[model samples]
Target chain A: MTRPGGRSARVRDAVHEAVVELLAAGEIDAAIPKIAERAGVNPTSIYRRWGSRDHLLLDAAVTRLRAKSPIPDTGSLRDDLLGWAEGVERSMRDRRGQILLRALVATMAPDEEPVEYLRARGDDLQNALDRAAARGEPVPTVDEVLDFVLAPLYLRVLFRRPVEPGTAARLVGRLLTALPADPAPRAGRGG
Target chain B: MTRPGGRSARVRDAVHEAVVELLAAGEIDAAIPKIAERAGVNPTSIYRRWGSRDHLLLDAAVTRLRAKSPIPDTGSLRDDLLGWAEGVERSMRDRRGQILLRALVATMAPDEEPVEYLRARGDDLQNALDRAAARGEPVPTVDEVLDFVLAPLYLRVLFRRPVEPGTAARLVGRLLTALPADPAPRAGRGG
Candidate 1:
């Protein structure tokens, strides 16, 4: 509580907590002044650190959401994907997370321009796919993973559509079915 | 140039044009009074007809966007989906449409509560699926269509990721592969 670095970190944590609490309460249009007040941090200090409300809110939201979405390691691609999907579904049920996702979606630019917020999300999915490949399982390309698995989940979340319990399983089943068949090596020389 | 019972309709059209023009110019936070001034419609009239800025923006955006996304009637499902995807890609390239989508995303309540703007979009996709079924083409379920076809398309539009030229074709190819093989009827009954 006393060290300089530790105090700064604590201030950051308090700010994140304050923003999340406000956003969860449905204050989608809450201002930086209110957030600073709630956090007990000086307004000038917040502005100096985050530069803008967008940057501050995005950081707080991403930090909280990323913590809840740790990749699972179940030793198989199917189980791993299903677990990850379920975890995401559970996480999506949080109103605060939905608010964050909506903000990220609204703020992102068109394709061909990089947005760190969205890219970080893709990285989580990519990490799961990489683990599957390391286990000798046939893996789809990252684009395929995004298209087949993650995109629908996001759509359902963003649209406020009910994601049935079996939705993720069904998606994984479809993705696996569409995967390229593993090529067999030559049994003998080119007789 | 409008007929009888058309004065209000003309006013609506003018308002829509003004809103679209302002939004396309990146005035995302533009207010209704400004919009009313631009459209030559009284502020009271705009407020009476559209209730809120969200409603007016959504109405204007939807009216403009729906006209640009006509369903394709190509001979085959492959051709049809590819054509539809291309049409959507073209439509998304419009800065105005992107702004509208972003606003819609930010404003939609969670999935348990249906929003008319989002539902209208699903109707368009469902129409295409219904057409394919009428043609005896193998059609994926609405959920599958949302996941495989629409999700990736939305992701590309929302995020700044590069969408390859053949992205839609590739998605369709994978989707077709995942579809259940057509079940053949038994030639011989219980003889």
Candidate 2:
């Protein structure tokens, strides 16, 4: 079993950190060789662990995206989703967020689904919904939140559509009024 | 002045057809040089026209995606959307549609929004909504259709999520009932 803070874990962390640094430094196109060098890890090991540069890039982006936007526990489904959606909108409007999203799209393949972002986002949504459920409030399934709230916002940003002022709140409001009641707290999203 | 059937237009068609052929033949990883050669055009000319292979691929995919899924005119919003959404769903479930979507994402950048697909899809939606409005039916904005109908479908497919049977109909149903009364048929989607 891989221990916490073990060599493998450390290496992974270091590589992820390097990726973030590179991205922050405006090197969105940095290659694995450059990242491995920065992380002081072997590129070969990186390939062994992550499979491809796209995978590695996406994994790091997911980490950064999640690290910033922890699911808020506002004690109400409405407030929690609004907060999270606003955070998502803000990030997507920024330079780094745009790059991360681009990397997310870049990593996607027909045969292989990118796991890092989906798993992390799913867990975050589930955690928020679970908290709302425990507080005796109704909660939408993860899939509903994904489609109704997340997809619309993210799609708008990715396509460079104009995100009107307070659009996130509008979307959140519409979602709360329209969807939900599934209560399948950890219900599966699309496959 | 670029004429409809002039050299510029002909070269573009040839290159796009070449891209579709290569993708259909399982050359998903084919490069520009190869594409240019296959199209019987110089690689430099391709770079001059499209700026990148990703752009060319996306342009071609958009053309294909639009060509197959012409928006229906059933004299009503609900039926038209259902018909069109079904076509989109059927295509996205196939191998070629998968590649086309992948190419769509690949071409997306922070600064440069891919124009071909969005323009075509927007026009298709607008045409359908216009028809609906003319028939005295309440029509959701084109943005509404894009966010509710198109984004959900495409995102699910790209993420390898199982689009449950009849989900397209469900989304279209939600779109019709959940939104509308804003007869601004050409209202812009969020940026």
Top-scoring candidate (DockQ): 2
| Candidate 2: pairs in clash | A161-B190, A161-B191, A162-B190, A162-B191, A163-B191, A191-B162
Q: What digit string (tens of lDDT, one per residue) describes model 2 on residues B1-191? A: 12488899889988988897788786877999999999999999999999988778877888878766777778777888898999888888787887787776666655664344587788778787777778777778777888787888877776667666788898888887786466654444434
Q: Which sections of candidate 2 miss by over 4 Å?
A: A1-14, A24-29, A40-52, A113-117, A180-191, B1-14, B24-33, B39-55, B113-117, B180-191
Please give the distance, in angstroms, between residue A80's alpha carbon in candidate 1 and its true position after superposition.
2.2
Please state the error at residue A74 of candidate 2 in Å.
Answer: 1.7
TM-score of 2: 0.83
Range of the 10 consecutive residues with the lowest summed lDDT in candidate 1 chain B: B182-191
Question: Model 1: per-residue lDDT, tens digit, B51-123?
Answer: 9987887787666666666557776776767776666666666666666666666656433365545556566
Clashing residue pairs, candidate 1? A110-B160, A111-B160, A112-B160, A160-B110, A160-B111, A161-B111
TM-score of chain A of 2: 0.78
